[model samples]
Target: MAVTASGVFRRTAIERADQRVSWERTDQAFFSSGACHVLAWTCRDFYPDQGIALAALYLGDFEHPLHVYARWGRWVFDASGWNLESELLQANSDFEGLPVREVETIRTDLREFCEKHVHRQPHQYWADPTERARAYVARYNPPWL
Candidate 1:
């Protein structure tokens, strides 16, 4: 089966959540095993050339989740995960509003961004504190760091 944009989104979400979990474990000295998962879609209006991306992130577990929606002009997060409604879907075309060719472009760009930059690489860090510190020093830090 071919991998879809939704699949890439889900996997990327999980990987991000897992990194958070690892950090939390290191800080709190407790371990919990679970990953974040996501459901995502895009919304577009060709006439206006406007678009939005929406996603729900099941953080660590499915019991509670975070909702995110973003467009060129706005970005929002709903911790309660209560805002999703049928009306929103209808208004946005369920992300099928853009031309068919644009769908592939969006998917490819998203996947590449997530894989290349957003997702953490294990080799970027080290188990030994000294080595980790040295690695950090050697690396070119981005603004986010």
Candidate 2:
């Protein structure tokens, strides 16, 4: 048996947060604000057959994406966890009544996505994603492991 997409999301989120990669500037849990797109793409890639796609939670304007997460049907997966689309909105007060756009065109390259969308000092996180992931899992020792 293999890990589910939600499992991958949870593990990836926690590990990435723990890694505290250079691009991230947050002391909060979950992924950094600017790393959402990369994290969402990672979750989608981990379960390609699951039809997981990326979606952007925008503020009042569609011109910018305030947050990004993976979506499979009506369910959304983020660093926080798996949640219903409505629940995700309600959980984040800023996005409670905002618009969410399903990203139709996903860039195949992480670097490209960062260059185009990430507002901060965007990083590709491609130096050794698997190795970096392992570093976190080793330190945290999640019970499910």
Model 2, runs deviating above 4 Å:
1-32, 93-109, 119-145
List pairs with backbone clashes in candidate 1. Answer: 42-95
What tens digits encode model 2's per-residue C-alpha lDDT throughout 83-125? 6767665545333355444344454465665567643323334
For each candidate in the order shown, give its overall lDDT on alpha carbons. 0.26, 0.49
The TM-scores of all predictions, comma-separated, are 0.20, 0.56
Candidate with maximal lDDT: 2
Clashing pairs in 2: none
- Model 1, TM vs. native: 0.20
Top-TM-score candidate index: 2
